[model samples]
Target: MSAIVSHRLHLPGTSPVHRVPAEVKIVCAVVAVFAVVATPREMFWPFAVYAAGVIVAWRSARIGLRWIAPRLLIELPFVVLAILLPFAAGEPRTTVLGLSLSTTGLYAAWGIIAKGTIGVAISLTVAATTSIRELPGGLSRLHVPAMIVVIVVLMLRYVDVIADEAARMRLARISRGDDPRTIRQIGATARGVGNLFLRSYERGERVHLAMLSRGFTGVITEYGAEPATPRQWVLGIVPAVAAICVCACALVVR
Candidate 1:
C-alpha cells in the first residue's frame, strides 16, 4: 500500500539551496525570520534591504513568485487586520483621502505587513527547497524537543490518511442518497462528520497498537548516510548571516 503522506509544499529543484541540508535550511529560515522581526518598524529602508535579500534567496532556490504568491492567501485574515489598522488603532489622527486616520496606526500597520511578508517569504524559501519528509529528520538533528518532533511528524503523516478516510466516507454518503447541499440534510452532514472523527480515532488506536507490537520506540530515527559537509553549511548559512547583518545595520541606524 502507498504511504499516507500529504502533498509536499517543496518544489523539485537542483539549486544550491535545494542541496543544502534540511537542518541548516531550517536554522537559516528561523534566523532570517528573527532578523525581520527584530527590526524597528520605522527602519523602512532596512526592511526594504531585508526584502531584497529574501528575493535573492528565492532566486537562488529557483522559486518564482507565482508559487509563493498563491500560498500567501493563508495570511489573508492578517492582511485584513492590517488593512483595518489605520482606521481603528491608536491616536494622533491625520486626514488621508479626506478620512481621518491615525499616524501611529499607519506605522504599526506597515510594520505588520512588512515584517510578516518578509518572514513568510523566508519560510516559503525554506519550504520550497526542503521536502516534508526531511523536516522531522532536520528537527531531530537540530536537537529540538523530542515530543514536538514526534507530534509534527505524526501530524504530517496521518493528516493525509485522515483526509482520505473522510473523502471515502463522503462518497459513501453520497451514494446512499444523502444530499449534503440542502439545509434539510445538514443534520446528516453533521452526523457524518462525527462518524468520520470516530473512525479516524479508531484507526489511530489500531495503528498505535500495531506499532507497539513491532517494538516501536519513542524516538523517530532517520536511516541515512553521512552528515552535511562544510560546503553545504557555508552555502546554507550565508543568506541567514546576511539577514542578521541587515538587522544589525537597522538597529545601528535606529
Candidate 2:
C-alpha cells in the first residue's frame, strides 16, 4: 500500500493536532481554505500569517514538510497555470525579469498561488494527522455526498493496486527492449494504456460481483462513540480562532 494511504490513517500519537477530533480538523481545514480563497490576493500579509497558521498545524500535527513535498508535484502544474493567468488577465503590470505582467495578472497569480497553496497545505495536514476511517466519516457528517465519499474511499483503496499493475507493465515493456523514444511508439503507449484500462475495468466488475455476493449497500459508514476530548476541542479550534483573530485585525486595521 502507498505511504499516503497509511499516512492519512490516524497514527497513534501525543501530537496536539493528532489528538484533536477528526471532524474538527476537517472543519478547520475547510474554513482555512475558505479564508484563503476569500482574502484578496494583494493582501499578501494575510497569506504570510496564514502560512504561519499552517506552520502551526504542521508543528502541532508533527507532520514534516518532507512528507508533504513529494505530493506537491501533483500540484505544480496547476500552480504553473495559475502563474500564467497574470498574462492572460486584465491590464499589464510592470515586468518581472522582462516579462510584461498586469495588476489583474499579478493578482490573478497571487490568488492562485495563495489559494492553491493554502488548500494543498490544509489537505496535507488533514491527511497527515487523521486516519482514513475517521477522515471520510468526518466528511460524511459534514454533509459531503455519500456517493462522493464512497468513490473516494474505493479510489484510495485501489490506487496502489492499480499503480503496482502499471509498474509491472512498464517493467515488462522495458525488459522487452521497447524503447519508446520516437513518435512512432506513441500509438503503442496508447494501446498499453487502453489495455490497462480494460483490465482494470474487468477486475472492477469481478470485484463488484464478489462484493454483491457478500452484500454492499453502497455507502460504508462506521465509527466509535468515544466523542472528541476537551483536549481536542482546544487543539482543533486554536488555529481557526487564530485565523479569526487575523481577519478581525485585518478589518480593524484597514
RMSD to the hidden true structure, all candidates: 3.0, 2.8
Error of 2 at 95 (Å): 3.2
Estimate the overall C-alpha local distance difference test score of candidate 1.
0.82
Q: How much is the lDDT of residue 199 in candidate 2?
A: 85
lDDT at position 24, candidate 2: 84
Q: What's the true lDDT of residue 109 in model 1?
A: 89
For candidate 2, what is the total of clashing residue pairs?
Answer: 7
Against the true structure, whose TM-score is highest? 2
TM-score of 2: 0.85
**What local lDDT does model 1 show for residue 196?**
87
Error of 1 at 72 (Å): 1.6
